[model samples]
Target: MDLDEARKLWHPEPGWLNTASYGLPAEPTWTALQEALAQWRVGRNAIELWNESAERSRAAFARLVGVPAGDVAIGSTVSQLLAPVAAALPPGARVVVPEVEFISNLFPWLAQAERGVEVRTVPLEKLVDAIDDGTDLVAFSLVQSADGRIAPYDEIVAAARAHGALVSVDATQGCGWLPFDARRADAVVVGAYKWLTAPRGVALGYLAPGLRDRMRPDAAGWFAGGDPNGSYYGPPLRLADDARRFDISPAWFCYVGAAPALELVAEIGVPAIRDHDVALANRFLDGLGRPPGESAIVTVDVPGAEEKLERAGVRAAVRAGRVRASFHVYSSEEDVDLALNALAG
Candidate 1:
């Protein structure tokens, strides 16, 4: 795919490289959101319309993440989805997580400690070995949000499988730029604002068939049960037999935007996008004369890092005394050159 073609979809000034923090939504996504809002204003958007939109959005997400549409649950945030998944575990169960994971992925499991659940916090390097026979669940981010270090999820998944432990992944940081199967884990949760290139307040959770069957929904609402009239009224609440049982009411407008975002990803194809992003990241690394890390984000220690990037007309995050330049389909050779030169100076 021509990078210029992808770049035309967003309104970023030339050389924006901060997709890891916030994505510039494609023009079509914006159009979809506006069209939904127009329908709402004109009284043309019935609950049925919104429900159909939700299903389409869910299916699009399933396609992007390599999961069956039936296994996908809709939520508004990672924390919203993670809490119930954590609560559903048996009391006093043992759970393991990485010490340096994004806090959204860490705190929910940590909260399980009040129930006498053993939460083992290990460094990323030791996360795979941390799972043992006693572990009931193992949760970690696919890509570390801070340093962009990709987790060795295959090893962790293998370890979890050997020990009969369930696995959950916080895939928000890696979902769009990196390709992987969400079904590999028992559950994978994502907030769509970042790399998914959608509006905020839309999140996705995928529950494997076995895990969905074994764990009951902890956050049951009327929508989770899939009522035909699309009514939010249920006297005796009945939950869904599938992953929809865990879903919460979504922002309808957000779903409108999200569907198109996934469509763009599917059109360009994830494997190609991954190759493009990794290549851009590698170029940045090579320009800096540094070794490549696992994913599209490349970080280097620098003084006044954020200001340097800003002066170079690049957008990135500088944290922990390191400058992190993240690439996506829209990033180009010019962006990397500017970032490398600014960092070097």
Candidate 2:
């Protein structure tokens, strides 16, 4: 979809600019959720009806990330999806991550400490150089959530490959507005609420064939089976042959809400959305007399900026002691000016 076409489908009030914390749902996503809830409230449809939406969301996520549908696993959260990868690590495996990385991508590896797993946290700028022969995995967010710095993806991947280490990316803060291809990493995980515009309970994960083979499907249930509908009562212990084996039981309502949002993102196309978001972010920065920023999320150190924004009815976030303003598909140049005017006042 074109930018204007996609913009009209969302309903964010003017001056809303907090997509970094959570997404504002589009009209289609809201409608799908309401319809699903209405059916549930009256018991008008079977619970299995909800399952289809999860599968649809999984496929849509796969398309957005440029991966085969079978290579994507449906999940409820980033940490939950990363568990198997952490479990599969050998005792004393060394993982490297950015010091200020979002906890979802860091905690899972840190939790492996009792198993002799060692997590090395370094500054984001040094992440690529941090990978060496001893590093077993290099995990980091594609975009920093606190300040919106895009990772040096090519350098990081090259460094990891040179050392025979695996690369895992948390795309939670980057996906919908950042153009990326999941094939570039060993594993890519996305918590879609922030930018894909889904509800809070859904996540999408991509596992390379080798990574999936190393990881155990410890969380596997009927949902992970090759035929979930038939595997409910299995003694056969059937699991999907690919990444679906890593699937967790889905949150029905979340998927019902996620499908349309994921589909909408795929239809709008990330490159176009990235242009729209970054242009607005640049507009905001220009008005502030600052250099243009590449990422859609911008952070500034104006004193009391957070309080100023709040007082002006401008929705944004305070992260790591800076006022973070994020633009998305729904944001416009007007939203950018509103925030700039608030900071000026």
Candidate 3:
């Protein structure tokens, strides 16, 4: 689907500028969720019906990031999925992260300090230069949550590779509207609620073959079993042979809603979404007398901007003492104008 056709899938209000916080669900996604809830209310079919949604979402996300579905894993949150990696790190290993990185990517490595694993916090610009033989892992957000500054993906990945450091990216802020090839990093994780527009319980990740071999599936359950249907109760400890081994037992209804949302994103295409969102962001930037920014999420230091937008019925957020207004494929020129007018007023 083209941008024009895909824009019809959502019905966002005229002044919603908070896709960076959480995305409003598309019509098909909302409908899929409502149907699943209704079915649950009456016990309509079975778990298999809901489970199919997880598989569909998994395959769709895999296509969006250019990796095999078998290489992707399902989980509830970024930190939860990364806990095993943190635990498995050899004692005294050093990890490099940006000082402003969201805690989901930071806390996991910070927790490793008990074992003498050093977690180095550098400015985003210095993050690439920080990688050396001493750095065992380079972990960060692809897009900063506070200011929307995009990370230097290719540079950081290259530096990590040159130093033999594993790269872990929290793409939660960048994925749905940004084109990413997950294979570039050892582990690329996303919580789909914000930009992918899935339910809160949906998180997806790609784990490279080499990295998958190193981490245990700490949250594994029946879903992680080699034969989930046959191994309802544990005994032989049979887990999946691929990245599926890292799976966390899913929240069924969440996956039901996620399937249609992620599939629609795939149909519309990430490169197209990137163009649509960034164009709106640049328009907002132009109105604010600032140059265009690469990210759909933009931050400005207008005093009382949050309160001003609130009075005008335009929804936005304040982060790091700046108003963070994010655009999405569903956002409109009218929405951008409303926000601009509110701030100017």
Candidate 4:
């Protein structure tokens, strides 16, 4: 969609925060959410009815990420999905993760450490190296949350697969803004809250074709089992063959909330969204007024600098005398201009 059309869809009030950390969906999110709530109330306590909506939401997500619907598992949280994969790993197996990964990616493996699994924490460079044969699984975020550094997934996947290691990605920060090839990894988990603009308590897990069968469901609820045909007794009790087996306490509301947001994203196209975000990021970067060597985002180092920027109505990180201003599709040129003028002042 063109900027003017896109602007009408997103009518953010002045002074609203533009942090992608909280997640931002396309303009139709509110309308979509209202519809979702209505459907959920109508289907409450009806398993078969709810599954229909859930399946539809899965298909929507699958299309968004370019995967088959069968590979998608709807979850309420990223941790819920990652937990199963972590439990299924061989005991004492080393799981390599980046030193700077978000806590969501780290906690699941840390839980494994409590179960006698070896959690190997290393810098991003070492994590890359450790994806060799001895590695059981390698987990990392597609984008580093703190600095917005995009990880090279192709390289990481190539290294992991060469060693026969499974690769799991926490794509929370990258999904709506980046092109995510879920088919490229063993499994990828993401929350709709951050980038997808869906309500909280809604997340998704996309398991590569054969990987679904490998995960031992960590918290299997009644909905996880059953044929939905009534012949099955006591909720079937067996995990599903598809990614749906990973779901716990099926959330119809979250499913509903996600529908419109994803629909809008599909309409806009992810590549177009990325281009807009990158342009905004560039504008913010150029406003720094520093020499090329020190113009990098997230590298500024001034005392109490982050607070100062915040007071100026700018969100940024100061490291090594450089200021890193994160920008998103909703961020206007005026935002960059303000930050630049503040630096000049």
Top lDDT hit: 2
Candidate 3 stretches with Cα past 4 Å from truth are none
Clashes (backbone N, CA, C under 3 Å), per candidate, total: 0, 0, 0, 9
Which residue window of length 10 is worst by lDDT in model 4?
290-299
> How much does each candidate deviate from the true structure in C-alpha RMSD?
1.9, 0.9, 0.9, 3.7
Cα lDDT tens digits, model 3, 101-188, are 8989999999988899999999999999889999999999999999999999999999999999999999999999999778999999
Cα-based lDDT at residue 282, candidate 4: 67
Candidate 1 to truth, TM: 0.94
Compute the lDDT for candidate 4. 0.70
Report the backbone clash tally of model 3. 0
Backbone clash total for model 1 is: 0
lDDT of 4 at 42: 91
Give lDDT tens digits, candidate 4, residues 50-127: 456567667778988888887888888888888888888877888899988878888888887766888887777666
Position 207, candidate 1: lDDT: 86
Query: Over the stretch 1-345, how does candidate 1's per-residue lDDT look in tens digits?
Result: 464587678776777888888777899888988888888999884666666767887998899988889899998989888887788888899999888778888788888888888888899999888889999999999998888989998999999999999999999989887888888899999988888888888899898888776766766777787663554674776677788988887788888888888778877887888888899999998887778766888788767768887887878987556887889877788888888888777
Clashing pairs in 1: none
Show the colliding residue pairs in model 4.
Answer: 23-194, 299-319, 300-318, 300-319, 300-320, 300-322, 301-319, 301-320, 301-321
| Every model's TM-score | 0.94, 0.98, 0.98, 0.85
Q: Candidate 2, TM-score vs. the true structure?
A: 0.98
The lDDT per prediction is 0.84, 0.92, 0.91, 0.70
